[model samples]
Target: MPLIRVESLTKIYSSTKEGFAGIREVSFEVNEGEVVGVIGRSGCGKTTLLRCIAGFESSDSGKILLDGKSVSRPGPDRFMIFQGLDQLFPWLSLRGNLIFAMKTVNKDANMKELQRKAEYYLELVGLSEWGDCYPYQLSGGMKQRAFLARALSVNPRLLLLDEPFGSLDALGRKAMQDLLLRLWGKTGTTIILVTHDIDECIRLSDRILVFTKGTLKFNLINPLPRPRMSEDPAYMDFYGKISRILEKDANLKWANAVLR
Candidate 1:
């Protein structure tokens, strides 16, 4: 059975006028240890779909099942790392935030165990010595690293990334991609990343799911070799294909708007 199964998921938002459709008739399954990337233009329901899976937003119809159980609300089983740098608590130091999650997840956890887990995750994210630093004292990339550490510290079964690298510069973004790939390889956590960067998606995911106009347009299985490089011929080809597909979808949207 799939680790995560989303069946005919649909979400609609209330409005004074016509209701806004977030996602309509979307369905997909993510297997254990599989990393799937969702790519699409802005306002194409990619984030909305992720939000539904993460339990931050409810679906009007359909079901989200994790480990054969339905997900009705947010829980630690599925940990989400958002795009915003302010995801970390401004009032607390990195150590405090990490400790809070560890304690919440394992109320019986002693300070020693919590400290060990926090240190391990901080080292994993290359932020070992910054535990005492507050969110306001860190750079954008450092803040993201802290968030990653906090999420992984809980040992979640699934990791949900919502444009987690959107705020990073090119170099920082590349570093983060590499870090995530290594972590995924080590922990074998099922990850579902929602991103607009075709190159990034192609590099990190074993399979790419394209969301167009609130529905899954296509799913591509990338057989490209590992330790992916943007200059590699096969990788470049896959990237170009996805880029074209996205562009085609955008053009169609533009045309429809003109007609309206």
Candidate 2:
């Protein structure tokens, strides 16, 4: 069975004046340990779809099943890491956040065990030296790295990333992407990443989903090899395909506006 099954899911904003503001009857399945990337223009419902799966939003129709069980509320089983550097608690140290998360998921864990696990994850993200530092003490990239570590410390069955490095610069984003890939090898956690950057999507995803006007228009497998490079023929092929999808949608939107 698939790890996640989103069947004919629909979530429309409450106001009709918004004119198709949310996803409509989207359906897809993500297998265990698979990394699926969601890409689309702004307001294409990529984030909306992710929010529903994370149980942060309720769908108006259809359902989302995790391991065949319907999801209706947020739980440690599904952990989300967002783009904001403020995701960490300002008052808590980096290690404190991870330790707190470990305790939340496994109440039986003692303080000593929590400390050990926290340190391990901090080291995993290369933030071991900054464990005692507060969120404000770290750079944007470092905070994001710490956020990833906190999410992994919980050992969630599904890791939801909503443009997790959107706030970082180009070099920082690339570094985080590499760190994510390295961490993926160690944890083997299933991931659903929503991103607007097509190149980033291709580098991290095994399959990609393209949305347009809140509809899942393209569900494709990435054909590029690992250690992916922009110069590869297959890389260009995959990029062109995704680019065409978005470009066509943009053209149609422009034509519609002209008619209006």
Candidate 3:
């Protein structure tokens, strides 16, 4: 069975003269240990979909099922890492942040045990020596690594990422991508990531969900092999295909039929 199922989920921001904006009957499933990437232009409801799954937004219709249970509110089962470096607690150190995250979800967590786990995750993300540094003390990339480490500290069932690499430079973004894959390999955690970068999506996702104007238009499995690069033919082919889907969908005057 799928780890999470979104059934005909819809959330509208407004139906007034300003016009409607939100996901319309979007549905999909993420299997266990799968990394699913959501790619779309701005205002395409990809992030909205993620929020609904995270229970941050209430859907107007349909439902979200996680592990066969309906999700109605935010819980520890799902953890979201945002695009900003603000995710880390400014008042807390790297190890302190991780310990805080653990204590929130696991109230009975032993202090010594939690500290050990926090340091382990810090080392896992290459921040072992930076545990004493504050959020402001770290660079943009380092902050994101801390966010990843904190998220892993809890070992949540599902990881929700909203363009987590958006603030980094190109080189920094690529480095984070490599880090994400390495962490994903070690953790085998289920993840749903939202991003506007096609190359990033292709590099990290097992499957890609293409959204256009609040609608799910294409659900394509990554056809490229591992070690994907810009020069690879298969990678470019998959990228071009998704690009065309977005381009063609834009030219559509109205919603006709959504591609699977």
In order of appearance, the predictions have TM-scores of 0.93, 0.95, 0.94
What tens-digit string does per-residue lDDT give for candidate 3 at 1-35?
89999899899997668456999988899999999
Q: Quote the lDDT for 250 in model 2.
A: 82
Off by over 4 Å in 2: 14-18, 251-260
Model 3 vs truth, CA RMSD = 4.4
lDDT for each residue of candidate 2 in 1-260, tens digit (9 for 90 to 100): 99999999999884475357999989999999999999999888988998899999999999999999999889999998865537888899999999988888898988998999999999999999999999988988898899999999999999999999888899999999999999998999999999999999999999999999899998999887799999999899889999999988785766889999
Task: Show pairs that collide, candidate 3.
Answer: none
Local lDDT at 52 for model 3: 88
lDDT of 1 by residue, 167-227 (tens): 8999999999999998898889899998999888988998999988787888888778788
The lDDT, on a scale of 0 to 1, for candidate 3 is 0.91
Instruction: Look at candidate 1 and give me any clashing residue pairs.
Output: none
* Native-to-model Cα distance after best TM-score fit, residue 217 in candidate 1, in Å: 0.8
Ranking by lDDT: 2, 3, 1
